[model samples]
Target: MSTLDALQAALAEEHATLWTYGVLGARTSQSASPALYDAVTAAYRRHRARRDQLRLLVRDAGGEPVAAAVAYELDGALVRPPQVQRAAVGLEAAGVETLLALVARSSGEVRDWALTEATWSAVWQLELGGAAQTWPGAPELD
Candidate 1:
């Protein structure tokens, strides 16, 4: 995939992550985890910001941003407490993998550079993601 292609893929991943978070947040009891709720909200905002950046880049290249899916596959059949945490981990892992792939598949100097930067950002994001999802309710709102 080219840089533009990688960007689009990253955009899609963002969309997917956004969707998954929405579902997970909704499934979780807001009252039960105020902190988690706040964190999730913040994560969404950040995702939206990054998404806009990606969209602008795509648009500047005369391409439209990929539309988000109306629904996600629920990331497999994980639904219980531990299952939910495991699911979150799985989603974040997938996002990291895609981002890394984008970096590897990228072409062009500027685009490659952007991909590299995005890859590093994702590495950091995944670390946080790992902690948040490591335990069923570790960073849960308390």
Candidate 2:
């Protein structure tokens, strides 16, 4: 895929992650857990920032950035702590995949950015559970 294509895909993933984090924050806020609520809020902010950056990158590359979907279908209700954590894990997993694609097809600053994002996603995954891979954004071998 081209750099534009990778940027577009990363933008889409960021949009989805933004929406997913909204759900996570809402559900965790209900429990009155300050820590989880703060984490979700931070993640939401990060995704939003990344989304905007991606749009700029796409435009600089002479391509129109894709818009976010009207709504995203989540795995399930995030009423409980475990449910919210699982949602976060799922979002990070998706991010890792998107960033991996970007890393593979991008160069210079874009490649560095993708690698950083993937590393952050991996850290988030580890925080959510014991989910850590040798290569965070790499596809698993059969």
Candidate 3:
């Protein structure tokens, strides 16, 4: 796919991630699990920033930014902290994969930006209780 297409896909993932984080944050209690709540809040802000960045990137690349869906379908139940952590890991993993695709399909500043984003997402996976993988984005290698 083209670089613009890859970027749009990554932006779409960020949009969904932001929404899912909101759900996770609502379920997580600051008093009961302060660390988790803080992590969720930080992640939400980070993804929102990424979404905004992607929109600008798309515009700079001469493409119209893709609009986010009204809501995204989540995988499984996210009632407990463990479940929420797992869901967060999954979201980061997905982001890493999407960013990797963007990295491969782009060059120069866009590729560099995607690599940085992918690195962050990979680290987040481990922080969220995911086992470290040799290739964080490439599940086929793990």
| Candidate with best TM-score | 3
Candidate 1, residue 120: lDDT: 43
Q: Model 1, range 42-67, lDDT digits (tens) per residue?
A: 66666667678778877766778999
Tally clashing residue pairs in candidate 2: 0
lDDT values, one for every candidate: 0.63, 0.84, 0.91
Better of 2 and 3 by TM-score: 3
- lDDT comparison, 1 vs 2, better candidate: 2
Tens-digit lDDT track of model 3 for 67-141: 989999988899999999889989999999999999999999999989998999899887777899999899797
Tell me the deviation in Å of residue 75 in model 2.
0.8
**Candidates by lDDT, descending order:** 3, 2, 1
Tens-digit lDDT track of model 2 for 1-142: 8999999989988998998898788778635777677777777887888889899989988999999999999887778887898788888888988988998998999899888988888787886773767766665841
How does residue 99 of candidate 3 score in lDDT? Answer: 96
Model 3 lDDT at residue 29: 90
User: What TM-score would you give candidate 2 relative to the actual structure?
Assistant: 0.91
RMSD of each: 7.3, 1.7, 0.8
